[model samples]
Target: MKRIKFLYLVIGLTIFLGCSKEEITSIGQQGDYITNFDFPTIEIFAPAKVGLTNRSKNADKFLWEFSGAKTITPQGDTISYSQSEKMVPDSAFYELPGEYNVKLTTWKDGEQKEITKKIVVEKQQPVIVVPENIGVFLEVTFAARVFQFPGRPVSYEWDFGPAGTSTAANPKVTFTTEGPQLVKLTVNDGDETLSTEVVIIVQGELAKTIYFTDAFTRRIYKYKLTTQSESQVEWIGATTGYNAFGLSVKGNKLYLSETGFGTRFSAGDAAIADGVLKSYNLDGSGENIITKPVAASLDYRDDPWMHTVDRFGNIWWTCRNWGVRVINASSSEAAYPAIKFNINATIAGEGVSTYFASDIKEVGNEIWVSYAGTTGKGIYKYGYDGNYIGKFTTAIQSHAIRTFVVDQVNSHIYFATNRADAGHGLGIYRADMDGSNIISVDTHWSMNIGSGGYSDQGAAGEYVYITNMDIDVDEDGKGYLYYGYRAISDIYGSGNPPTLGPSAANSGVKRYNLDGSETASFLFKGYAPYGLAIDQVKR
Candidate 1:
């Protein structure tokens, strides 16, 4: 049995040796190209591509083997991967950061040569830190703050508060609600992934508001000071004959003088020629229910241009041609015209019968008046009893004043004249409280002081407002100051001199900065805004 096993093994060895010697002599005769077993040295950063450049010498076919097949694509070389080329390309890129043993086998004439190379992919791990809570407004967008390892050539995904999302690096986002919101940011660089979360505080729209009167459309418009939204004042179409000429607010009550020439004082024309002085609560309750009547009383006619309420609840208003008139107002019964001031009483023996006050406002204990007449036209001061105190324009050219605005903290009185043509006194001026130190502040005047080609000014404030009759209402609602006059395309008919009440696209107020630079224009839309007032109720 031992001799038989030995004989079989000896025969098997003899056969393999004979075949090997035959194959070697045949390959030597055939001039096979498989000679070098070498590869190029490769060094690169992690997660980047690797090149399997063919630099072998005298090779007919090549095979590559990459270990740890899980992290690599086209995992390992197969039996059919022997390509007929000296330089062999890789199947896919390497994505993991670790040393890999790559085996290369070259074949020519069925003779094979093999080599191995150690590829070290260096590591790059970045740290990410998400920010804290960021406050954002629900109506206004907020630019997000982010701090992360930069220059990584990474892709990002952002989940902004619940459902909002963005791909921008520094994204401006508006949240849906007002509260603490959650945000998530995820970053990835090939095989590396990182993410973080933060809270964001979102603010909501405004609740309280500011009001304006549209004299032409017989309505009042309100602007939400906090949210920057504008709409009409309440009790508008609810009550007829609600034309507002000038507006004043005191303790939840909005007072308006809505009288001018050739105007129907109604939403439906049920007025008595001229407009009426009326009041409405902040929520638009109590329209002309128990206040100053819409009729002439105490020998003073019922034509008031603008009105103001004193601390005593008395109404001091401009009575058109009848100077200043005071009315005892109440929420109880219809009030009567109390005191009338046709201050014909001479100052330095000059009777000022042409002294017709066009607008009035109360600052502190005294009431200030802006008038437009042939004589004694300036910002005039008066006591609570309708007695004339002094004239402010006496320090400058005293003529043709229209609106009065008193800034108590600065002791400066701002007023605008009714004339807009050449040589007319400044369309707007500022002066000391005691009728001195007169200085012009308006920057748009001279050729056409007011738009619509008329010579009269309207609402003025820290942002001065100008009333226009149907000027650029449908377009941008803006007008420019050209040659010192507000230049907007005239909306009135040819040869028609402008009037106090205008129709159509209505009016807009241009807000001018203190340096006379124009800031913004808020259109009144459906109404002609003649006068402006602010409600001091804190919200």
Candidate 2:
């Protein structure tokens, strides 16, 4: 009975101790609590007094209010809060000039934070300050110089106090007559404006000027020849045209053959059929058409193509269907048949087409005609009586031949042979007036010479000038020959070929010496300037 009582007492004690420990654990778990938490700080990188927007990231909520605003509201990252008293971006574009302060309050998770910043709205207009010293001179054409501060003013206006007109910006203006003139210039940006003036004294004549005339813009500019100042020379309209193919001058008269304007053509016939041959004075005055009113035919196959003029002032030309014709120097309207070669009847079965007549020279009583047929290549001679004086044949098919005064002091007839496919460089040959004792000095293709047979066009020389065709000799007795060389781009184009322009490899007029040395060239303005004539006029 005593043992049983002890067991009961021990068991009771253990149960009581376990109950007390459970109570303590429950109190400790309930004590883990938090209160009065502060919100996280915010750092703003924007300027102070700025028009603020809620740009905070990862925030649950926001309570925003500006310093001077009447009401406060909940704002988020997407919500922007603005105040009428607060300045906005671009609001004072050209008005206000300085910076301001602004404040923002953000609230998230029952916590509130405030931010402060400064902002500045810039004016669009610039500040312009004109320079004080402006240089002046005696002549109205004197250079008008002005300076400006900041160098980037939006607008500038210039007034040259005399009858002279007003211009804008930094400009150079010349006066017509000489005297003291007040020059004024105004500069402005949207925000600021400034003005500057200077007294100018100009002297000297404003007459006699240089000018330039392009094909499209026919405005002739007149620039003072003394100081290279330019002005308007002439105003040409639809009445004035351009002729790229034909240009010749006699005395003070200039003749040009025009082939209509624009690129409208059908089978070589311009819409305004029959091209015009017009004449004008050297000073761009007294313009009139000398050719007959009947539309001048652009018939290269049948009619006469005026190639060049001779020393005697006679216009010598050739017709494909007919023969050669001569125009009197005094009257261009009068044309007479000087000689007609009976090629069709004389050659019979041989295919012949008179491409062009080479240069003509009158030796003694006979006129030498360097004629080349399409099939038979040779130099044909004709007497003053229109009688054929036989021919001298070259090895290759000849297209054209030019005669140069070879040693006029020695009276030797030197002609250059234009063979079609033989080679580059000139086939230099010398013959008598009757075409005898033919000697060939093959130049061979040098770096100075172009390639192939189509290259040899014309040659010119004094005593030492001998090329396939054209040759010009300097005082050193060396010969420079001018030849027509077609490039790969020439045969496939419609307009002017690249080989005929200023950047051509072998275009324009070429110059060489007697021993085939010191070759140079000059770019001719016209396209394919096949005909070249140099004569001394009584300027």
Candidate 3:
């Protein structure tokens, strides 16, 4: 009797399994419909006309509910068409910026299923045009770009924080404070309102500010220097991670290069990794890591030592062992490959392999890079295409070339070096573009500890013995050269020990006229400046 009961159950189970596999159902069976639809998942800007398409199967009836949407008629008038019994509804228009729901319901054989998807409409912000450079007490013009609303009249209101507010489309505002000022713009188009904000950084009264990186503190500092205003040193509040070495200012951006994971004395391919090149807005906003190393392939040879930004938006950096590398500032790659000039190969010597490719600068359409190592010591010039032009200068090759800057207005190339060599005597040297008529710019103060100078590391302790320099013209059309100076108090007379290193009285940044005359001495006193840049834009 039990075997007969089991046989009956097995037959029932077999019939049920066959029905499920075949998807065979009676005319009034439940759950036999597929409800599906699609809408744009990309940003939908209002007023947006979004089309909803049906992809349902085995459904006898369909319904669509578009939350609070209107459909445009053939005569151009918008009418409510929020709900429809059709499979695909008319194009729904989202007049305002917000989130809306789209519901699709399908019914088959007296059973029903529904699904809902969200559609978000984004607000289109008005475009605001602000001047690149703004200074305290300086009147600058701000404009709201014309954005047509077709049939509706537009009105603009600008809120320049601390500078007051304006209703005019273009407003001339004079900021009274230094630092970031949040400027907002709101546009009303009778039907919809859109808004946006931008931070307008108001700089100090100086027409030009000298930006320098302090490697010891890993911080950025600025010295506002102008003949018309008081010279002041302000911390820029931007912290550069490990081994901050280079700073370059192009337009409203400040670029920095950090040789990650190694000290200046032991930096090499094997000793380091995680190097990066980054950029920050002059106001310290928009901090971004432009490039770094890819994890799977680690090579510190691609580490950025010193960098420069060209007008073409290309960032050229000198990798200590790998020569120079170039990548567009807008690149989104995890790591950028180096343009291996194998620059050391350019020099003919056994020790050329140990040659360190140092600071790089962008002069017009060309790139100039300085190299200093055991063998070759000079600046090499390259075309904008990364092809080596020639050896820029061996004039001061006796000294380790830490940095060099081109003065187009003055037609001079300034070289700042260490090692206090006999012929050139490590300081600041200026030469013609062709490396002729080399003149001493400023070599009187103390330089880094190398072949000739004493080591200050034991006392105050210097991390890297390097000097960075830059050139910028003022509003008065006068060009000046600024270079970091690590002065030994007794370089000439007083016998202060080398361990005493850089003193507050003599160590700082030195400013000189284009013709090699000293302008300001002992600026940013006591701080050992490494990387230097100048905001050349007239603020």
Per-model C-alpha lDDT, please? Answer: 0.50, 0.37, 0.68
Give lDDT tens digits, candidate 1, residues 1-539.
Answer: 11110010101011244445442111222443543333223344444454454445555566667674222335543222323232344332444457877777777657898877776655443322333343234333333322223355656677775547777665556554657777777767555676767675554343444566653444665554343333344534423243245677788787766654322112222323344567787666677733443453322234566788889987777764556677655544455454466643454356667655566777777787765555656666678876767655355336566566655544555566665323444456656766566656554443342544423332111111232111111123232221112222222211111334334343445443333355434333434455566665433
What C-alpha lDDT, on a 0 to 100 scale, does residue 44 get in candidate 2? 17
In terms of TM-score, which candidate is stronger, 1 or 3?
3
Model 1: how far residue 411 lies from native, Å = 3.2
Preferred candidate (lDDT higher): 2 or 3:
3
Q: What residue pairs clash in candidate 1, if any at all?
A: 54-87, 220-233, 241-266, 392-435, 445-484
lDDT of 3 by residue, 152-234 (tens): 78888999877899998888998877898899999887776889888777887747778887534668888766654576777
RMSD of 2: 29.7
Best by lDDT: 3
Tens-digit lDDT track for model 2 on 65-112? 333222222341222334432111111111133444445444445566
Q: List runs of model 2 lying over 4 Å from the truth.
A: 1-298, 306-313, 332-359, 393-506, 519-528, 537-539
Candidate 1's displacement at residue 374, Å, is: 1.6
lDDT of 3: 0.68
Backbone clashes, candidate 3: 0
